[model samples]
Target: MAQDEVEVLVVGAGQAGLAMSEHLGARGVPHLVLERDRIAERWRTGRWDSLVTNGPAWHDRFPGLEFADVDPDGFASREQVADYFAAYAEKIDAPIRCGVDVQRVQKNVGRPGFRVETSDGTIDARYVVAATGPFQKPAIPPVVPGNAKVVQLHSSSYGNPEQLPEGAVLVVGAGSSGVQIADELQRSGRQVYLSVGPHDRPPRRYRGRDFCWWLGVLNKWDEAAPPRGAEHVTIAVTGARGGHTVDFRALAADGITLVGMTSWFEDGRLHFASDLPVNIANGDATYLRMLDEADDYVARNGLDLPEEPEARVFGPDPECVVDPLRELDLATAGVTSIVWATGFVSDYGWLQVDAFDADGKPRHTRGVSSEPGIYFLGLPWQSRRGSSFIWGVWHDAAYVAEHIAIQRSYLAYDRAIRSSGPHLTADTSRHNQDDEPTVTTTGGSAVQVERAAGAQLGER
Candidate 1:
């Protein structure tokens, strides 16, 4: 009914949004951060009881604080991480509106700002920042056939092996999440069937040192470097079991039966890979090659490194002869549950802005977008290999805040000139000319064009 004004509006008060809010607050930027639930609700509610961080504690910290004397190599439990995030918000004194769900954001007509409509009310702001993460949606593969008898649940909903139905549990998707869930099920005496797929495998540690130590030594984590093509770039796949690596041999040693990729599930029969071991071996080789390439690059770059002590490589023993599939049936194998540790997707239906690309991903360059004053942070692969990591979001958050300050300075100058009167027509004309549209080359005969328009002029 009435207009509420703010300098900036940040949607989602998770790690990304909180980081952005901290930066803005430190710079004295007047802003409000809206969260759909209490801060870090996803981590508190969505994660399983045994869920420990894949990243090391040292690397899993938010901006302005560390995990506090915890084991650097040890993984922080779900609760610990969630509490740490809560403390982070408190430490920064971030002006977060908890439990405020933003419904939509659209360009304001006849005004020099955007209008954000939330469940509570509407707020007018000069800028909007969508800090919602890629994990906004859970991706359940379409190929998974329905079985009313089989209790099905995405990895997000699964908290422990107790939640699954009684029988041999088939865990689909051999990524990090899949492997971890499979291991958990087997440990709980459930017959676990792990679906093998194309996945990256690396040692949890090399030469007795943490794998992340190697990443740092090699400078592979550097964000300032030019973009290496997708093929050359290595990312930390979030759900991978060993953090950076997958140790299938360990799973086998613990009596977990690996299965082929699930072709389809029908009539209570979960048909999966017949050649599970071979597929697992192939996947391991592919990932090892990628890691070797990264190692070579480090050596070629003459990066200094520390000598690591020897460590045992995790793999299946040559003497171990276990059937990959059908080795243990759910009913006979004492398996009571299944957990789907598949991947995630992004959803931004709440925001009414046309800032997303064709793929439905937010369009941003170093946190700045084509939509003026709208910024993004903590995105996967935003500016570097570690952009999405808890430790790395700070770098992006600071960069975005700096850009916002620059823009604010520019806006203040323009406002001052307008209030000073019409004697400076030449300056105003030059400013207007600078905002004119320009043409650029497209790939083919067509051309891509953009106006250097200012948001102060309202939607064009």
Candidate 2:
């Protein structure tokens, strides 16, 4: 196996990885980006053909790149997003090696830095940036005990209503994806059943502005954090007929049946949790809370924003609501398919290090890992609410790059000083050297540290 060394090794060539690469390049840092597949692999293969981002093109940007020749207010389709990243990678001439699967990433205790074992070879990197993103793996629950007669599909594999089996469809987990799929299936004239769960809801438009636009104006992305374990709010907007907010009330009016959380599948029947009405109420409350926040923000800013639309309170129709049925015989209900849109999980099985928290998530402070020389990017609320989004990753990338640059300078300086003599011990005395060297960069940033001409280098 070939052994290659680099100053930095960024895993994943999606928006996050590409952003990191651009920042590192601007700082004159020598780094390589490794992608297991083509750029934006998930966007290319995981999304439904009709899907468009909940946010508009204007908000979709990576570091040093913005969506061009696209409708600023309109959502970018899955293809458009994939193409944008690909173009950005090409435009920046990012040093990306795609089609290389990383087998494992472990600290190089024998020396310093990390040893990245890939299918192709090994990458010995001084700094390793895990830009593989938060949505690396889909979160499908363990199989609901049922006969193999029932068809199951995750949101990632779901394409359209036509792809589903003929009959009523039980769309599980009423987040944005589940609801959207249910809506589409019903619009296609199929019987759709939605299983509700705890979720945040924000109106698509409030006070004559896109919800996201208001979020930007109010600096929502800059929020220190979301509630721990909180999932991203499902922006209840759809891509059909251009784009529009999906009203569950309207869906109920249009014959879509809402049910409670799916607890299990047994005896050839699907069982639902008995908290249907409560979940619906909670979700609606969340929606109002968001609206209240927006209203408060406008008032605090002293902006003469247009008056909010007549506030019609949202609630589940009593007729459509029910004490969760203990079980529904799929055959009797004519439900033939199930679409699970529970969420995604971060899987770092290939990472052989103790960088994760008790929740199995990488423990990092604003992208700086607790473990030195390692970094995380593209995580929801990693630095702020927008960290997971394309528009938000640049900030985190810039900070990570700066840290890496500083660490590099310190290491180089230490190496030089070590080679000087026995007079300078590797203690606090090393800091007193007046003739310490500095790293000069084209980006106008300078890092200073003590230096000796021919000292042995220490791993950063």
Candidate 3:
């Protein structure tokens, strides 16, 4: 068996792993990035054909590399995002071993580091960074009967309306993906029914600025997590239609039937929760809360941002919300295909270390796992709400890289601290102070990864 050794091993070469690789490389940390398939495979192939980023190109970017020809306010198509990551990888000269599947990672019994088993070989790495990202597996519920006679697929596998059987399409889960797919199907002359569950409806643009700008100026992305009980509530926004406010009622008016959450399928019919009205009210409440917060923020800071009156006003509820569809005979409704825009669950079953909870969630604080010499990245609310995105991941990766550099410089395991000057500090906030996500080094050249980031507006 072929085997090799590196000081550090990075698993997965998605946005997270690539960001980690560049930071570690800049810090002179001997690390190898291993990818099971291809770099940014999730973005390149795991999404729908018409999918666009939920954030504007300006804010949804890595540090230092402004998109060459994209509109700053326009959202990037999935292909463009993949290309950007590819370009960034080429520019940084990331040390990635593509097609190498990491099988298991475990702590060495007699050694102080970890034993990583991969398809290529096993490696003895002093540190391991699991940057496989949060969306490891599709979280499709088993509510649909195993023997149901209909074409059904997870949103990750969905390509377009033409990919489905020629009949009414039932799109479940009214999250970002759900609503977008539902609207698209309806426009394509397909009778579409959307199963809307609890969600947070934020405007695509508010107060003469893109919501991304508002999030930055108001520090909303810096929020640690959502309010209690709404932790998993999907943020309903879209970059589809050149980026517009996500309104269920507008979709309803467009002939897409809005239904309640799918409850069960039995007794020769599909049952739905009678909570459509409640769901609508909850989403509206959140929507209003966000608008009010923005208003207060502008007034508090004396900013001259224009007011959006239409935001404060609301029209009548949709007919489905007023009188929710509680049950439906699939044949009578003419539903022939189902698109499960359900969520995802992180897969860490291969991790032999006990760095995770009983529920399989990695136990970490700001990417630093509870177990020594282990770290996890690209998790939601890892350090902040923005951690899962590129810019956020860049900062988080820097912090993790800084931690690794600090450990190497100060600990210098089995040896004395070899003449230390100014050590590296994991200052995540210091980087956030800049408009474009720029690295701010607080130590020697070991972590001097800063590049004067570009903020030039784009036009795609």
Candidate 4:
């Protein structure tokens, strides 16, 4: 019913969105941040109650605000993370509109702007940024059979062991979420069965320091890259022990039954692969490779580091290695619940733009979208390996803000020139090559989007 126009319209008020808002605010850019729920709603509603950050508080700092004042050494709980975001929003005075669901975002057919359809009203924006982050939908496997007698929950919906039925629980996809949930269930005195898969289980702490500390010292953040083939890795941070690693070997030692990938469930029997030991061996081998890399880095840099105890290779027990179960009778095992922790996929169906690739991932060079006036933030490997992390989004946001400012400046200059006699062209002699608005994406090329953006936006 109402038309609100802005220079920038940012969708989603999570870490990425708020970080973008902070940068925009600092540059005196007029932008509105829209959120379907409260800020950091995912942390509030999606994660389990016992969930803590894989990294410590020091890594959670935004640009201006630092978590050092709160809990620099401790991992932040979900509530703490949500509160930190809220506090950051307040401190930055971010222009965030919560409870505003954006139904669609498309090019304005009547004008040269983007028409953002929200639950509250329509917004005509010169630029639209989708900062929804990576987790839009939970990725549950279609192989999960529907059974009326059993309860099933995705990792996003799982709260705690007490919420589940009084029986064994099958945790699928042994990534960070799966391992953590399985560990919790087992420790809570419930029989837990974990489905093992190809995963990177880096130790949370090594050499008398947190693994993240080493990562930071080696500038690993700058060299960050997800291991090829895996969507994401699970760091396996232990809850009560703080920075302890939660590897499969440790879990097995704690009496948790580890199985191979679950193939199917039919007639009260759950089928699994017999390559459970192979999976365990593969994980151990990967861990060793990472450990070696860290050692190599320390040696090459000649950085004085505390000596870790002789690293011991961990593998499954002889019995497990010799004989792996291919199936589990749910009724006999008393398994009444299953939790799927298969991660999530991005969904940008509401955005009517040719900014996505065949895989449904946004096609952006850095954070700038290929589609004019559309950008993306908080995507993994968007600019750097750290692009998706809380501490990483600020750098990308800064670049995006500067690009937008340059575009706006160009627009204003163009508008002023048009207001004068049409025969005179704007002076371009004062500008230098470096002053031109350009951004470098992962593609290793510079893209300039400012030359005629002003005149183009003027028609909106």
- lDDT for model 2, please: 0.78
Comparing 1 and 3 on lDDT, the stronger one: 3
For lDDT, the strongest prediction is 3
Looking at candidate 2, what is the lDDT of residue 193?
Answer: 86
1-460: candidate 3 lDDT, tens digit per residue: 3778888899989999989998998888889999998889899899999999998898899976988768988888888998898888899999889999989998999878988898988888999999988888998888877678878899999999889988898999999999999999999999999999999998888888887787887787899877799888998999998999888888888898889999898855789998888888889888888788889999998989887898877777778778888898888888899999998999987778979898889999999999989999899888998996789999999999988886675444113213433332333443544333322224353323323422211211
Candidate 4: misplaced stretches above 4 Å? 68-70, 223-225, 231-240, 313-318, 420-460
Cα displacement (angstroms), candidate 2, residue 421, comes to 14
Candidate 1 regions off by >4 Å?
223-245, 273-279, 286-338, 420-460
Per-candidate RMSD, Å:
7.5, 4.9, 8.8, 5.2
- Residue 274 displacement in candidate 2 (angstroms): 2.3
Cα-lDDT of candidate 1? 0.68
lDDT per residue, candidate 4, 1-460, as tens digits?
Answer: 3889998999999999998999888777889999999999998998999998777777756757776344677888888889889998999899999999999999978667798899999989999999998889898887756754778889999999999989999999887778888988999999988988777666677766676776676576776556677655454445444756766766877878888888987788889988788777777776677678778887898878776745655554745445777898888989999999888899999998889999988888888988888999888877776775788888888888877776665555455466763322333455565454443322223344454544322222
Candidate 3 overall Cα lDDT vs. reference?
0.84
Residue 410 lDDT in candidate 1: 53
lDDT of 3 at 50: 95
lDDT by residue for model 2 (23-60), tens: 99988899999998999998989887777887777776
Q: What is the lDDT of residue 221 in candidate 4?
A: 72
lDDT of every predicted structure (CA atoms)? 0.68, 0.78, 0.84, 0.78
TM values, all candidates? 0.79, 0.87, 0.90, 0.88
- Give the worst 10-residue stretch by lDDT in candidate 4: 438-447
